[model samples]
Target: MVNIILAIVLLIILPYIGLWKLFEKAGRPGWEGVIPFYNIYGMLKLSGRPTWWLVMILVPGLNILVMIGITVDFVKSYGKFKLVDHIAAVALAFIFLPKWGFDKDTKYTGPSASPEFREKYKIALKKTPAREWADAIIFAVIAATLIRTLFIEAYVIPSASMESSLLIGDYLFVSKVNYGARLPMTPVAFPFAHHTMPLIGTKAYWDGIELPYYRLPGLSDVKKGDVVVFNYPMDADSPLYRPVDKRENYIKRCQGTPGDTLSVVDAQVFINGKAAITPLNGEMKYTVQSDGSEINPQLINDLHLSDLTPVNNTSFKMNATVLSVKALKGYSNIKSISPDITPKGHADPLNTVYPELFPNYKITPNFPDFKWNVDNYGPIIVPKRGWTVKLDSLTFPVYGRAIEIYEGNKVQVVGKDILINGQKADSYTFKLNYYFMMGDNRHNSEDSRFWGFVPEDHIVGKALFIWMSIDDNASFLSKIRWSRLFNIIR
Candidate 1:
């Protein structure tokens, strides 16, 4: 995921970062310009070089060598050529040349390069294959996507929120056949903007202008407990946020079916009041500090990182073992109850799974041992079709009216005041349906609690397995975590 982010950042920001460094080294102020070409001029000036060198940049053959020479000269003149930056600047042109031209800090002053600079430069570029590989990757991704979307789409995991099952960094080949492949959403959407119009898409032609497509419904019913991804419906006016004019996809495990009464008590999930037995509950994943050493956060009792609470900022918890209840209505924290899973050889005792239901108690949370957290918050019910719910009536402080409402043009908004297709609703009676999703590393994720329910359109596909599990929390090689690779997601 981080690599993907870095690649993407390099794509958009590299041009600017490269331009800035080049300009600064040329002795021009970094902020003096924005356009790519003008920035090139700035680079010439900062390096005490001439404007005439600009012609070489556009030239076809001798220009490549001249450009690399000039780039090396500028960096060396400005004292910005660290060992790595040199490799990035000349050898890895696609990877580093632009990056050198734009992003580095050319703020220092040093002498020019020696006579043998070009000879050494040629060798450095040959050694690091990441650049050439990056080029091949781009071509491969394009070719694969062209063949796949029109033919298997590739999916990459971005986080360990799906841990214990599918480790972060897992990649899967999602068959377009399963969901009957959705046509690209932004077929006509303006590049960065989501509102005005869509980019290249193939939906039906309504009257005159082009209409991008919406996928025909259902390859199969999205099963209960399947891991899925979908466009964020709460996406709207959020700055720098591209609307899901294209399907904005998110991956999460489905935990509810339409109309299933759901609740969380003591950090455990209860569907229709029966505790769910997730294969890896309270599983430990270790992370290392900035220095090269590992820290099993779950073992740090004082840190309280492991306490599953129904609320945010669990770092505030004082005692790992003491989750004292405060002011919840009709509820009192029962002390000394253990929520540890039963011994591996036997089934859990029934008492550990279900809390007693009562008439006065509107919320019977499932968590008996964890802190007050999202995984510990519900005993709340999910509404189904024909299930009439009164706005401002229930005690579900977590829910009301405004949810991830889609208004077209890939716009989505969330709040307490929204309606669907012109129907006034604080809550819906359900025209289609809704589902609940949660992360596997349950306690530390920002999920359904922050966003509203996951609507059907947002559904992607189940994450079936893990192909790789690189623990970001380990020594570089030790971080590979071989045991977790190829693990099956339950």
Candidate 2:
């Protein structure tokens, strides 16, 4: 509260003080510069600009661009048209205006923006080549940074979780505008580094000036099947504290939207009691049995079947896409090929169980006998904003992590009751919407079924296009996946 009050006071007082002195230096009544809209009018008159520019500054989004142009003109009116001067005009205006207006060495010379005035002063204020290059690079970084924050950014597929749909080494251009670009929570950070500072292996960002989660207007709403990029919410504090936007980025298909009931039966996803349509090209593990002879290696390459594990030579387990599964059936040496699906009621073998699955079913009593596994998971409803859910021993395990960690509330389970922040509570009203995300590689991917729901605040953007694709296994001539380049990601 005190910080907010201090910021408000500074916003009100600093501009008034700086602009008053600036107008005085321009031969106008200093008090006239402190009067809201009138101050803008005075500024325009001194810079030889029309009053219509003020209207242009009032429009949303465009106001920022128009105001920057006006500031450049104002700085030029004082005979400071250098790149550094323009940067000071835009970024340090509150301080720079006061310095320029009060300094005895700086004097107003009718606007220097005019070509005649620039040419006359060019010799005395000319910049060296090195300095000019530095200035250009600085400005370019700023422009690119703004576009990355507000429009789109390039991302690369770091893993094969979304195999066949999105592959490893595929370079993508993620569109932040699809689900609205999130304003960076921790704005001061090492450029181009996500979590670690380059070369140092230390933290990249400062959390001192953290901002609340905010998103700009977006092009479209996130839908059921859209491939979405989002911050890995689980990594918020695996080893160190990090802001929301700086967490690792993970891409997956949106399996369930808020308020939708979602479940997995025999490795197939279902939403609202109906089987969700799987992506046609999605890959899943399948057990393949061949005739008593070594399977042809060329056929395996043609089908793109990989990660083959031999089961007595005659049979093997491999991750294969739908098209690959169809082609494998046509091979004379192949006897049988079927999906490696776990039975609905059975638990995975002790060696195959992933202990980190959500709700951590291993904790007893709080979650007595949770038979749910990756293949036959919940009919749990995704939480929506303002929806209230009753809390008890049974329900607590399902949402305990969400309320305590993500929502930042203190929770306790006392016998049959639940306490939130030391107060006995029967229910919890979700503060944010949640979605279910999963990789296209059904049996191979680790996603929401393993970690849990993705809170709305963690959403990053829509996966738009694959700008480039490289195949590590291919020889030089075919190293580039020519067909995949420039393809729009569905």
Candidate 3:
């Protein structure tokens, strides 16, 4: 809040203070310059622009361009027509405005935007080709930046976490408007780069300036079964302490919306007390037993089976989609295929080896007897905006990081008591909603079962469709996956 106030003072108030002096020099009342919207009205009148431009300045994305145009015209009215002076007037307004306002040599010449002034100084105002190119480039950058930030952005599937639902090589257009375009929390950033600059491998943004979380009104709230892209929650900790918007993006299917109690039993997700809809093309690890005959390599390729390992001549392990499993069952040599589910009482080998990978492992009073694995884990309630939860050793591990780090509350455990914001609290109400996200590649995904819930502010957009698909391992002639292109994401 203090930062916001300081930004307003520096960016707005200080420039208006200089405008007060400039207005006095133009034979207008000095007070008119500092009166917010009225000051803009006064500037339009002085610069001979239509009063309707004030409406344009009030708009969100368009307001940026309108203000720049107005500033340039206002500077030209003061007989400062050089491109450098216009640049300084708009970019370094806090310093340049006051400098020009107090300079005795800087005097009001004429309304630069008016027809009469342009007609009188037509030759002097005529733009050169280089100047025209510079103007065009500047306009393009500002316009493109606004579109990318508020409308839609292009993203590529870098990993197979989304699997057959969204392939590894698919190029997608994620619509920011689907879940409301989130206003940039870290406002000052490189125009095109996300978190880091390419080639240089350095930070692309200055995190010194930040804004509070806000989103424009959107088509609808995030729903269960939606393919969503969001900033990785774990990036908020340790070595990569990126700002919320700048964290690495990961796409997954939203299995549980806010306030839904989600759990996975024997690799099948259950919401509340009912079975949830599974992804049609989602893959699962399975153990396959075959008649003592070698499986055809062509059959393996055709089924898109992955991670195939021979346990013996007749036994094999592989990851396959439900459709693939059914297709493989048609073969005479295949004996049986069973889902490789971990029993309820046991933890997954990976989770057991790296306990810290599980979200709940960090709690002080650990659940020594609660051995939950990826395939048989969680009846945990997802956090809702206003829902309150009791703070105890058992529940702390599930919700502590959210309360302490995500919500910006100082939490400490003193013996058996939990202290929130230096006060003893038995419960805490969530300020933001959270969703449980999981990958379609069930056994291979490191998701909510590992990192915990994704905060609402971390959500980026919905995966709209695939615009292109490339099969990197294919021959040059078969490089493009034609069937996958333009497929709408389910």
Write model 3 residue lDDT over 145-251, tens digit each, in one string: 77888889999999877776777789999999888889888877998999999999999998887778999889999999999999999899889899999999999
Candidate 1 vs 2: which has more TM-score: 2
Give a tens-digit lDDT track for model 2, residues 181-230. 88777766877788888787988887655666778888777899999999
Candidate no. 3 TM-score: 0.92
**By lDDT: ranked, best first:** 3, 2, 1
Candidate 3: segments with Cα more than 4 A from true spot = 28-36, 54-60, 85-95, 98-105, 350-357, 362-369
| Residue 402 local lDDT, model 1 | 25
Each model's TM-score?
0.45, 0.86, 0.92
What are the RMSD figures for all models against the true structure?
A: 19.0, 3.6, 2.4
lDDT value, residue 15 of candidate 3: 94
lDDT pick, better of 1 and 3: 3
Please say which candidate is ahead in lDDT: 1 or 2: 2
Write model 1 residue lDDT over 377-434, tens digit each, in one string: 5555555545656544343233332233331311112344334455555544444456
Name the runs in model 1 displaced over 4 angstroms.
1-143, 146-152, 173-176, 189-213, 216-219, 245-248, 281-375, 383-389, 392-404, 407-429
User: Candidate 2: lDDT of 288?
Assistant: 88
TM-score of 2: 0.86
